[model samples]
Target: MIDSFLTSYKIILASNSPRRKQFLTDLKIPFEVKTANIDEVYPDHLVKGEITDYLAKLKAAPLEKDLKDNQILITSDTIVWHNDTALGKPVNEAEAFSMLSNLSGTNHQVISSVCLTTKKQQLVESVTTEVTFKDLTPEEINYYIANYQPFDKAGAYGIQEWIGYIGITSIAGSYNNVVGLPTAKFYELLKKLV
Candidate 1:
């Protein structure tokens, strides 16, 4: 459905995440992989969607001058918010354990922001998914941390992994948003922009 609109445009995905790559690919949209080293830090006062939006736009800022007239650059950021705090990727196993412990048997928000930019204009939006986790045992948490090594994932966990399979009790929004990108919303926005 999007192929017709995107026929003359070049799509560039500026992320190292395989999931985001696969999501775009699965949409039958051809794109190239491009990444830039952007600091993901946001202002200390930013919260929830603000933080994700800032980070997503930050990731795209470096590519502004590189954009061609007919090329679209996509950038995204995902974070887990629990108890009014944002949980980013874990720095170590200890932090992973602590994050999981705090998330066990709790409801949290997974917020993902996506930015689509061209040389002429920029569009940014975010999706928030509410995830409820069942009470996780110590053994379960340990097994997941040791096996999955979720250091690269926000909130120290991946919802598509074993931990998600066993720990998630309910979710109130897009599962893909929790994974990394909100595919439906992304496609919808692309349709409008294309």
Candidate 2:
């Protein structure tokens, strides 16, 4: 269904996330993964969606000059906003544990933004999902960390993994956003352009 919308254009997914790649593949959208190594740093003043939006747009920048008239490039970024701070990918076990501990028994916003660029148009949109986790004990967090090794994931957890199976009590918005990308919202955006 989605492929029909992009029949005339080549879709390029510019992200390293396996989940994001899988989501687009499951949608049966014909796209090729093309990633660029860019500094993920952003200004301190940017908050939540602003931060992700900026990064998503930034990820698209390097690909701008290479876009052909029939090629559309998609870039995205995800951040876990808890207690007014953004929790990015943990650098080590200690940091991951610290992040998980802070998220225990609390509600945090998972913000994901997607930027789409074509030769003639650019569009960016974001979705936020509020996720609530049950209070996780040290034993459980440790076990998950040891078993799953969520070092590459933001928020020190993956919603589709063991932690999500046992820890997440509820979510207020798109589940896919928590996983990584907001597929429904993204589909709507693509539909509009086609």
* TM agreement with the true structure for every prediction: 0.98, 0.97
Give stretches of model 2 more than 4 Å off. Answer: none
C-alpha lDDT values of all predictions? 0.93, 0.93
What are the clash counts of all predictions, listed in order? 0, 0
User: Candidate 2, 44: how far from true, in Å?
Assistant: 1.1
Tens-digit lDDT track of model 2 for 143-170: 9999999988889999999999999999
* The candidate that achieves the highest TM-score relative to the unseen native structure: 1
Off by over 4 Å in 1: none
TM match of model 1 to true structure = 0.98
